[model samples]
Target chain A: MSEATSELYSWRASIIKKQLMALTGLMMCGFLLVHLAGNLLLLKGSDVFNQFAYLMVNNPIIIGLEWLLLLVFLMHTTIGFRLILENQRARTKAYAVRSTVARGSKFAFISMSVTGPLMMVFIIVHLFDLKFGSEYLVVQSDLEVRDLYRTVVEFYSSEVNVAIYIAAMCATALHVQHGFWSAFQTFGLSHARYNRLVELSSDVFALVILIGFGMIPIYFLLGYS
Target chain B: MRFTLRIWRQAQQETTGRFVDFAVEDIPAEMSLLELLDSINRGLILESADPVAFDHDCREGICGMCSLVINGRPHGPGAGTTTCQLYMRSFADGETIVVEPFRADAFPVVKDLIVDRSAFDRIIAAGGYVTVTTGQTPEANDILVAKENAEEAMDAAACIGCGACVAACKNASAMLFVAAKVSHLSLLPQGQPEKSRRVLTMVREMDQSGFGNCSNEAECEAVCPKEISIGHIARMNRQYLFAMLLSGERS
Candidate 1:
């Protein structure tokens, strides 16, 4: 395509991507909160957590929900890849001298050009380890409830795995930190006090998830398991 | 105080542009940025070189004509102020300043520090105005616009068509400019009849003019001489989407 046609195409694609990312990211955020609540059952004890996991695994309703989650994950990844590729292509021409006006959240958003794909890889690895690995309880015919907890513990016991998980959590945290406020801004949700509150909540939620997910691996590494 | 001014000079739209440097000495600190340019112009004339060409009428910031990118900022560093109002005191003595006309593929250079922003005028001509017949003046209170809406209309109307937002933008997007015109008229009851067409035509013109798409960076709001809110851009987007979906179907 010619530059003009290509430019117009990319502009439309960007608008579509913006809407898709916001919708998917918001949905995933809701899922994360619920997932966190469910996982907190581990704090109660192994039986409670395992029973919860078992119930989820055995229920046909949840099986349907799992399919929906997979669909959402696929859509999110596809849109993310398109966005990243377009951004890279847009900036392929190197600037002889960078303009001084480059500042603030604009730079942050451009840097997301790098962080977004990293987060995608992290998510895939995350799903593979927890959902499809040998430790996955749903795949084992004679799986005991306690075996689920042991599998999680054993997965984190390896130093290399622990390190990888922590890095992934950090990338996820940064992605959420920038993406949350940006989605709000894009949707025209700007009231100063409310936006500040949203920003605070985003930061707090990101920190909590990072620490929450990071702690699991550290727990095993430090012999808590 | 002495300062080096790196000013862009170009004779025509098709010609290549480059920055040329000149030094001015013993300049008063309180002189407005425009006045500083005037001083340089005077110096150029005395030295028998071509006087630096720039556009300005109302030197008092209200007229948006005096647009410049000063030290990489639209209308210098002062927030919510135009180039004509930006005083030389904002800069330190011996500071090197770079001045350039608004750079955009849509806004081609006409001369040094002056661009043909006629693209804006064309976009406005696309359908920026309300369709009222010329006759006796209507009573102000005849149309009962809610006070908030009236205020918003006035705020949007404050956009001076300065083109600073375009110059300040990374992609040279004209969303802020187009939004101002669209929102200004759209806010009032008198402007409602042609509102749908106004947004559609203006946005189409904006895109056709080779302006880039808005990424919601808010840089336009940051550099706008009128301090027009990015909220207008959102309103414009909403209106455009509605117009595209509803109005286009009827047509």
Candidate 2:
């Protein structure tokens, strides 16, 4: 193929990958919100949270949805990896000689190229630690949901893990802070009034995720009985 | 009022350029930006310094020759206003203004604030015309065009071959300029004979000219004196795709 054809093909691939990443990433954000809500049941004591975990595990429809979520997660990660590589290739030059003054939203959107991958690594480690590790899935019993809570608490009690979690949560916050509103802009849903609403929503969601996730670790660190 | 002007000066195409500072006094607020520069040039001539050379014609803003990056914006701060139309009143008194030529790989600086935008001409020369016979003039309105289509074509045709869009773009992309030309001619029935070939050849020439790809950041639109929408870009992409597919069939 000619160089133009190759460039065109790669450009089209990057555009498609961006669309896939946005769709799956937004869906995963929804999952995170729901997942966090379910996890918060641990604050109510072991029985309440374990019952919630039991319902999720026992429902056949929920089981199918879990697989769907897994598929979306994998698709998101694969496309995200492709996007990062393409972005790097597009910016082969070391630094920009002429830097334009970009709006705040544009700056945050561009920086997503960096934070997306960091969040990917955090997601993998998180899944491995809680889902595949000795907490819940290895035991195959709803009772280990309580053990999962204790493991989470114990994990956060460490300064290193707390630091990592805090850092990861901060990355997540920035990612969602830009991602949420940007998705709307990409889809052409930007009116001035609605644009402000989307911006507000992005900030609120980012704050909730940062404080919500960060607080979990701090809760244990603070000796919450 | 006196104003400090940081103007880029280059002696030749191969010579390195630098910002040379000059102060101009007693400039009227009603004076357009080009007039302000003229005042500075007059001062340089008196001082036996080489007067700055720039391009301008038809100070009415139709000629598209007055291209300058004023205050870090293409055509200054006025929306949908050409540089020649921007008056000194828009800027603060005694303001330090930086002025430079439009920088792009396709457009190289010739001297002072002037750059050779001949790449656009070459892209147009590639295939921007209709392949109609040159015998006799056709009847008036021989091809019935819809009013909306004619209006859109006129809007696109209003582009005066200015490199403002390219200057305003962060990536220095010329997609808007190419799109406007292609769209203007492609929309009419008289130009239909060579529409597909025109888009394909012109787009190929545009790419070969080393202009960067359009990332749809809308900076071009923001600073476009014509206020050309990026929608023209989408239309251009669609037209190019159709041309490619049809040209493949012809081959």
Q: Which one is best on TM-score? A: 1
For model 2, the stretches where C-alpha displacement exceeds 4 angstroms are: A1-138, A141-225, B241-251
User: Per-prediction TM-score, please?
Assistant: 0.79, 0.69
The count of residue-pair clashes in candidate 1 stands at: 0
Worst 10 residues of 2 chain A by lDDT: A1-10
lDDT of 2 by residue, B120-184 (tens): 99988977787766889988877799997798888888888889888866556677888888888
Global lDDT of each candidate: 0.73, 0.73
The CAPRI classification for model 2 reads as: incorrect
Where's the lowest-lDDT run of ten residues in candidate 1 chain B?
B242-251
| Per-prediction DockQ | 0.17, 0.12
Per-residue C-alpha lDDT of model 1 across residues B57-133, encoded as one tens digit per residue: 89887888888788778788888898888887888889888887777767777888888899999989988988886
